[model samples]
Target chain A: MSILSLTAVELGRKIKAKEVSVSEAVEAVLAQIETYDKEYNCYISVDREGARTRARKVQKLIDSGELTGQLAGVPMAVKDNICTKGLLTTCGSKILESFVPTYSAQAVLNLENAGAVIIGKTNMDEFAMGSTTETSAFGVTKNPWNTQHVPGGSSGGSCAAVAADECFFALGSDTGGSIRQPASFCGVTGLKPTYGTVSRYGLVAYASSLDQIGPVAKDVTDCAAVLEAIASYDPKDSTSIKRDDYDFALALTEDVKGLRIGIPKDYFTDGLDQNVRAAVQSAARLLEENGAFVEEFDLSLVQYAIPAYYVIASAEAGSNLARFDGVKYAYRSKDSKGLHEMYKKTRSEGFGEEVRRRIMLGSFVLSSGYYDAYYLKALRTRKLIKNEFDKAFEKYDVILAPAAPTTAPRLGESLIDPVKMYLSDIYTVAVNLAGLPAMSVPCGVDLKGLPIGVQLIADCFKEKNIIRAGYSIEQAVSREKCEAARAAESKATEARN
Target chain B: MADIITDEMIDYVSILAKLELTPAEKEQAKNDMAKMLDYVDMLNELDTSGTEPMYHVFPVSNVFREDVVVNGDDSEGMLKNAPERKDNFYKVPRTVD
Candidate 1:
């Protein structure tokens, strides 16, 4: 098998054992990207030279008997929103198209310190404002499973890259289901670490409270490994939680015995496709059969999740994005009459339609007369959602839900109606609102052969619980596939006999 | 739901957001914002009288740090990305009349 197709864990082990060289693995990934990325549109920038230099340095370290870090020699991709020193970190917007940060984000530094070579920066929705990557100024990323469908957004490129084996794993920032939705659509394992558990020092803020940088990879194990590398506290991000180092990789035991998995009834309600609902329900059953207790529960506050998320996210986005106004380090309008005109023209020209729409809504909601009516009310509703999750966690260790309402939609199907696109994130946004860790793992495929993902959510700092539960679900799914293959093999033998 | 967003409201919001919208774009924004507001009006159905607002997920307040310089001054590196720069300062249009 090609080295590019191996999981991050397997590749790391092989590279360390000298059975595979880091250069060869990097070359394989580069070759794959060269051949496939043009069609997939998964990457915005590929740092081929930088990756080669890092891989060669890692090989030298391995030969000299001084190799260290869990992910040594593993090639990875980062979402374009995360700042990389001297690399083009355009958050998939024309405003910052030429903007390159002199300093790297904390997560990037952490990944590099762990010896993971970042091969490229992936495309994303403009400032992470949309559900489908169609809003990206660069271009929409296609699902690797089928070229006609979209890899869900705003971290669509990260998920697509991992799904296409352009890289072993990729880093994606989650604000209102950006990471998990795409992972679900692309048939990969994506984890959104509990808010504040991962540092957001250089992650361009979409919504400060909801934004988190997490991992997308081939499976739950690789997701856990990448999460371990990037999860840390940095003083630069004031919201970053100061905690002892966690070994997420050590928590990936396929033992869900006695674990309580709560299936929220609202998630299975109308608007969810039958295929997606069936796949998630089967995931719950798999966990139950593995000795875990599965029960239906009521999270009554779910209906308000979408409204509150949009209100708060747009408001925060307006305030955070107010920094770009033809000044400092972004695009500027050459035909400006004056200072005010320049600011208006620069932003109007630089931002995409969805981005401008969100900014307008944000500004409107935060305006003097509307603050109490919209923004404040949304915050209060956010508290109610958190209270509901807190109540649910008392009886359940983790909640099971469909990651998205359906499998990957056709490329332009969701973009026509904005509200319809917002509804796509119904099941996953509540976890971010509650500041909990959640993951999307591939469980089954739809009738169209597109992958379906099931979400597992845990209370704050309880990522280990979900990881353990997710590991069990992944094993059971694979076991079912194996059993089907065996049955087919025996049937064929009998037919021949 | 009331028609909370009008053309005037869109223009006012555009100015506040520092965005220059064309006449057609203004109409589109008005309609889009109206639909979004209609959707968010779902919050009006909830009774949150006693619930406190949660601006942040974490219950963190007043996170202070030592008043020491961690990153040394790198004016050259910071200015490298400036669209227009002059001697470590960003160049912009004159503000005073």
Candidate 2:
């Protein structure tokens, strides 16, 4: 039964051995979705028949001993922002509620080519603007651990699907901590690949420079497997990094024997929640015990990351989202008389408040007289932040920090002040601004029994180092006692039942 | 930074972006836009002398490719997605009407 609890690699081995047929495993996932999705709000839609059909094809291939694809029969889900052919790629917004993509995203194409079965598109922050997926025009996705708390966002749904066993792995887009923050809250491993590492062809543009499609899975190896499947250049997206240039997954081994991890002195400041701090410190100690050096490095430039990230991401978001005018592919205002009215009514009524807020902020910063004052300056400051990271990597193999300042907060706690919600992505956003690769792995749990994640940020195109360090922690934490601690509270419930 | 970005400025941006905003919403935007801009202006205090501005983190050159007929000619797929399409093109409102 631990095959249900195994890594994607282990599961793939079982499938290849025909010990577990693809259809049986997929049906079990579907059954789990049916049983638990109501509690977590993890899925926007579940393609039961389509998943069964896909699973049957995979099963047939396995029966013929023709399992050539690396991820044959693996079940994966995608964030709704990805353009899966014929699927409603709504980006969790009302505007494109009826719009479906005619073409698949290159990343999705790669996954399908490798025989990964996509079950459905997961929910997200509308247009990937907000930190909490509560910004979705559709309902908010609840944290699988505690329904009352948020799973973090905007990749909350993807992270939850994997954490709650709705799917083995899910593809999520990280514009600004969308993937890692949610993964942290949901007790999963999520990777934000270096900016160009993953193709952004059909990501429904949200701050294009910051956006990247990454993997969320139960652990680091699955994250690496999903990353390997999706990471490649496409002619369609100019920003896509060619795999020939950087074979990031090729360097995955337990070789962090002498690798140094920088713990930014600024990160462990006065206000970091004591439990989250303790959890990360404990993880650092564990890594130290495992024969790696953890030393404090000063990234003074990171203090400005939040402000710089907002200026740059919002400005780019304003430009990218401008294409969503009613005249184009999405939902148009029906009753409008002219072009102007149509554009106004369509976007005004169509966009969620968070989307509108970003667009408005984006517009304001890039507007006349303020262009040189805001947008241009932020671009310059972004370089400084990247320089800090680039310089730090010269000294340290990877940078270690808390995935989030704290564990998942109660759903409505920070939703009121939109500014405060943006602050939640503080630690993870700078990695986006710098376009670095980072992974969040479940290192430890707090006193409250909530899972805590430690972030390992590697240099650009050096995802192997990320997984190298992350996997060490993953293996150390995979022991019987460590694993038991995760399920102990649940075992108590079983005792009561 | 002004306490208010004028309706005229919003109109200017809308024109540049090919988007449109309403008068009442424009008034609301004028207020909201000001707060957002002021937040951005907070960065003006930082000193960035001798910094090389970079748009992308990866040092990729302009990825110009030879323009060829790599058309997405999946007509049935395209037409199937359109709310209203006729004869392979998207159906639109008449310009004069």
For candidate 1, the lDDT comes to 0.92
Tens-place lDDT per residue, model 2, A172-267, is 999889999999988999999988888899889988888999999988777877888888878889887765554445656655678798899899
TM-score of each: 0.98, 0.93
Give one digit per residue, the lDDT tens place, for model 1 in A382-447: 999999999999999999999999999999999899999999999988888889999999999999
Considering only chain B, report the TM-score of model 2. Answer: 0.74
User: How high a TM-score does candidate 1 get?
Assistant: 0.98
Range of the 10 consecutive residues with the lowest summed lDDT in candidate 2 chain A: A242-251
- The predictions' CA RMSDs to the true structure, in order, are 1.1, 3.3
Residue B71, model 2: lDDT of 67
Q: Which candidate number would show the highest TM-score if scored against the true structure?
A: 1
Model 2 segments more than 4 A misplaced: A244-255, A483-497, B2-32
